[model samples]
Target: MFKALVVEKNEADGKTSAAVQELSEDQLPEAEVTVAVEYSTVNYKDGLCIGPGGGLVRKYPHVPGIDFAGTVETSADDRYKPGDKVVLTGWRVGEAHWGGYAQKARVKADWLVPLPDGLDTRQAMAVGTAGFTAMLAVMALEDHGLTTGHGPVLVTGAAGGVGSVAVAILAALGHEVAGVTGRPETEDYLKGLGASRIVPREEIAETVKRPLESETWAGCVDAVGGPMLARVLGQMKYGSSVAAVGLAGGADLPATVIPFLLRGVNLLGIDSVMQPYDNRVRAWKRIAEVLPMDKLDSMVHPATLEDLPQLGRDILKGQVKGRVVVDLNG
Candidate 1:
């Protein structure tokens, strides 16, 4: 038996209470591999799965963590074996099947990736979905040929998980990072993550009267997708691309097509979940090599499984500071 944060719905009322409950090995879903899950972290998806806002959970007694790292304990497939370290993310495993919130997780072999060098299980959870999404955005921009001389790179939601790592990676790769956040208090914090300057969320939130404004960003890793994303589109440089990762502000994108037709701006959508295995492997490997650990450390804090309830509430209220690493055995 092992302990896991189990969310059961009040069938009569549709509310959820995520309580730590003891579970047997058979309780886990059927898959080709059984993992001794070491660490899992809360992402925005996890917050929703734990609470009501996200509309992701379709059943009661669900496990909500979307990302985890662990060691293989048993495998029916030849691709992996016992004692091998592995990482699991995306794949709708948390939403459609059992996920990584417990001491054990059985996942499809196709959903697993060999943990890249330089990142242990705990550190992999430190990177989690947030940092991995950040890496995908960075790769999308770099693949679009964005360079240091292309001008200042803008990162929205700069103080959050994805923003923090995106800033660090872009800066580490030689581009000047302009971080956007509503929290003025995190200015020094953002700079310490290699952001060269801070742009108030208001500065980016303000809408442009004209369809196309003076080109400001060479490329952008935009995490907030509302009017903020809509506004940023008008200010993008010619032929520049924006990797849209999250919709923290809202999902409704009120944008004009002028930026695309006139400036040749590209709106590239990035989805970490349901990502192909090869892409997932490449992104993780890139994250291991390019993400500045010291900078990433500055963007992280330690949490425990017991703390998930309150932490879930905090993230929904926009009070979370950075990546939260959950030490399961602690």
Candidate 2:
């Protein structure tokens, strides 16, 4: 028997509890790989899955962690073996199937990515899905020919996981970073991540009075959507693009096409779930090359399985910053 954090619905009580339970491999889902989960991370989606009807989790007693890193404890596939370190993201495993909020996980062999040479299990989880999403955003911007010479890149939801990493990455690559966040206190933190300037959330969230506005940014990594994205679309430099990665602000995008027709601004949508394997490999390689561990370490908070319930709730409320790496072995 292996220890796992199992979620259960007590229908009469109409509440959920995440608790340690002994489970057998036979009870685990049928998959080619079995990972001894060393670390997992809490993300925005995890919060929704844990909370009341975030419209993500459809059932009770679910183990919800979208990203994890660990060693292969068993493998029926030739590509992996016992002691092979691997990482996982996407594949809709956490929401639709079982996930990493446990001591062990069984998953399809094709879903695993070999741990890039420079990172360990903990650090891998530190990047997790959030950082992977951030990496993808940067790559999308790069494909659009965004560079330091074009002026400052704007990162919305700058204090959150994806925004925080994007801020550091773009800045590290010699581009100026202008961060937008709702919290004033995160100004210093954002600046520390190399944000050259801080743009108030209100600045971009205001109702757009014009179809387009004065060009303000080289490119954008936007985690908040809705009106915020609508406004950012208008203010982008000619031919610039915004990598839309999250809908924390809201889903409805009340926007105009003037930015697209007139300035040629592009809105690139990024989904970490089900990205092609080659692209996933390239992203992790890029992350290994570019991500500064010191900065990643600075943005992290350590948690255990016991803390996930509260941490998950906080993430949904937008109260959590950086990353929450869950040390399952602890």
Q: In model 2, which runs have C-alpha deviations exceeding 4 angstroms?
A: 12-14
Taking the tens digit of each residue's C-alpha lDDT, what string does model 1 give over 1-330? 998888888879877888888999998888899999999888888888877736788777898789999999999999999999999989887777788888899999999999999999988998998889999999998888788887999999988888888988899888999999999999999899889899999877866678888999999999999999999999999999999999998888888999999999999999998888889999999988888888878877898878888888888888888799887777
The per-prediction CA RMSD against the true structure, in angstroms, equals 1.0, 1.2
What is the C-alpha local distance difference test score of each model?
0.89, 0.89
Instruction: Record all residue pairs in model 1 with backbone atoms less than 3 Å apart, i.e. clashing.
Output: none
Cα displacement (angstroms), candidate 1, residue 182, comes to: 0.4
Give residue 274's lDDT in candidate 1 (0 to 100).
Answer: 82
Which residue segments of model 1 deviate by more than 4 Å? none
Report residue 34 deviation for candidate 1 (angstroms).
0.7
Per-residue lDDT of model 2, residues 241-275, tens digit only:
99999998989999988899999999999999989
Model 1 lDDT, full chain set:
0.89
What TM-score, over all chains together, does every model reach?
A: 0.98, 0.97
